[model samples]
Target: MLGIFDDLAAGNLAGVTESLARDVIYENPAGEQYAALPDSGVWRGREAVVEAFRRRAQLVDVLELQQRDVVAEGDRALVVTYQRIRHLLTGAEAGYEASALLSLDDEGLVRYWRVLSESAAEADVFDSDLDERLLAAVRAGDSREVGALLRRGADPNHRETATGLTTLQTAAGLGEATVVAALVAAGGDVHSADSRAGGTALHKAVQRGDLRTIRVLVEAGAFVDAVAPTTGHTPLMDALWYKWPDVVAYLLERNAGLGLHTHYGFSLREHFEYELNVNTRGKDKLLVAEQLLQTRTREDERAAGEQRLMAAVTEGDQAAVRGLLASGAAVDERFPVLNGFNDLHTPLLVASRDGHTEIVRLLLDAGADVNATEPTFGAVPLHKAVYNGHADITRILVERPGIDLDFQGATNGYSPLHDALWHGYEECARVLMAAGARTDLVGHDGKTPLDVATESFGAEHPLVRELAALG
Candidate 1:
């Protein structure tokens, strides 16, 4: 019995049962008087005793329990305990006294345990009225009274019978950010889901299109991507379904999943697509079909603008390129046909290959990837500039941040310098060499840049002489 108490004091439930016999019996004097108490005051067998203790734990949060008169002689012992416990729901605290009688088995494990505490029966516990009062205060928007009720220990996680929504969910759905914060402060479970649909507080906030409430719930540790079990709808999906573009944008900014599918065969759109002749207003209740379509419209417009920007870049039209870029053209537009400018490469690659140095500068400043490659030869902008003898473009390309100076082409394995030397572009080769391009890196035919240079121009060639000098 002493060992059991010591284990329990150490917050070890497994250790508490170490000294209990398999057939242990437990009796509490107040069990018959308290309907909330388990086992009607008498629990037989070790499992039943443990379950009854667990039920008692739910009813009261024991802060401290000290024991006295712990007399053990032979096979019997009497232990007197004074406990300070807090009511689970009401948060009221009080002190109570109890006495336990235990008999030891042959192995020194407790075979029988009996506790006498009639006052424990009257302790405060789960109250439906208090829960309703908190719910009422929330519904009434009486944040002050709601805070007062929470201070009085109203269970913040109480589930509503009719709606299956927790108190926090209900408050969140009503756009009551202050009330949500108060409930969370009072031990409200931000992750608790509704019993009916398994939607959490954040989902409820999305339904209301209340970013304030959503932020409050999130700040309180609510999961941003918690999916509703019954609907398979994340908070972001819920925001899209409700036609709340502001909420949708906020969720997207927070990195919400865009490629998620619902349980009822509804797939969330990953990117905006233009619908030819159909209305976006949803016919079914599960989705609103509004914000996603609207957002797709904006994306389509931006895509058209980007196509114009690509056309301007291809034509070397500096003014048109500047205007389109200022109006928001993505630095790397991956579209196939851009305003009739058919190309399999990016703006920077086209600009560099065509010797449009100003356009190349614009694209670079607009955040184009310096190492972006073309699909045809798998050659980067540097390869294009050096192979085409664009010495100025080669200089700019090498000077750009994150440029791979020694990157070998995927197809021919020629570094930028090798491509320049293989094409007899001494000026581009000089620019590459001055930028510290490695001369020893080999190409696809197992020939170094120097070997390619010697093959292109004789060893008497000054470029070849420079390569040999570097060696």
Candidate 2:
């Protein structure tokens, strides 16, 4: 269907003659004011339509063609198109948009076609002053007028002819959220950079501490981490430089990248450090930026300490584990493992399973739960110690004063002693027995510790021998 225009521009009317009915009527707006262009009028029949377009082919040449929309209802269709064309006489190019209303005949050929718009190549598109009008409206904070201008065909990508400040940039710099939203909805380019700074509307929003406007821009798909070409700083780094953690916090929540630095070599934390070192200004507000960064650093450290606590336990580093606990790491955090399931558990649970005896004792002293079960199998730390044959950890756990020595596994219903003997850990079983672990506890298999041990070492198993001697 769009080939109609290409055919028209190329003076090849034969290809489109079949799609046009014998009695088709073509109407368009073109006039004497457009010198050398066809006057606004109507043409009846495919022959008249062919001649009319031939006149245009003689007057202008198409440079680029853009189709906006094509809607059809049954045999009728409407096509909205924008074209950039150069006048043959003046050798001047300009853009024009027109909507073509088309109606198909009984034979599926266009019987009635009309180009609806008063648009002219030179007048409507290069209206040179429309961009200034839109920018001024935004600068004056007139959202209503800004929207009116945009709806009336003001370019959303308008930039200051002098300073390269865009309409969206001006709205964002002024923190006018309504104007920003209106412009963005009108296809404003959020990524347009300030000519001087090479920063985008997002950077302007950050500099003004306008979180509301920032949010609007961000939601409109503004680049969260676009670096300024001049300074090589992102919006987040700009927020940090201004000492506006409130803005920084908002950007971070929007998933802005952390650890971004300036071209001068300073991270977010390093910037805070620089604030303290070369901060000879002695202003109260400057100190406030320092204080905010300090608080941010501490919060990040506390969160990192939680993961470090697990690493210390996993590596069996007793002192690191003790220091982390002393520094207020979570004593019973259920850490996730290989597949990101909450199968791994508290520092004490990890230390116990890995046979880090001193770390186990340290975590227990630091109030780590001695009997917290992992979510995967609901096995407690004592079960992990015995299953892994950490008899020393098992003994330390059994003497913890309130250890659940006979706590059954949620999956298999085995007590710590049953799990011990089932895994052939006679030493772990001995520790449980010395701690007064119940031997009469029945498991899911209807077997006791004596039954499980008899399978391991025949009748000479220690559990079997101990019970027989008691008899």
In model 2, what is the error at residue 174, expressed in angstroms?
1.8
- lDDT tens readout by residue for model 2, 1-471: 566766655556687786688898988765543322453488899899878776666666777767789998998888988888776644667877778899888877888998777565554333334567788888899888787678767887877767678878888989998888998999999988988879899999888888889999999889788888887788877786666767877765554545566677776567656765775664455566556545555654565455888888888888898898899988887653322333356777778878899999898898988878885577899998999999888988998978899999877888998988888888898899888888888888898878888887689765779945544
- For candidate 1, give the lDDT: 0.78
- lDDT for each of the candidates? 0.78, 0.77
Clashing pairs for predicted structure model 2, backbone only: 30-40
User: Considering every candidate listed, which one attains the maximal lDDT?
Assistant: 1
Clashes of 1: 0
In candidate 2, stretches whose alpha carbon ends up further than 4 angstroms from where it belongs are 1-128, 243-245, 252-258, 272-282, 307-471
The TM-score obtained by model 1 is 0.36
Q: How many clashing residue pairs appear in each of the predictions shown?
A: 0, 1
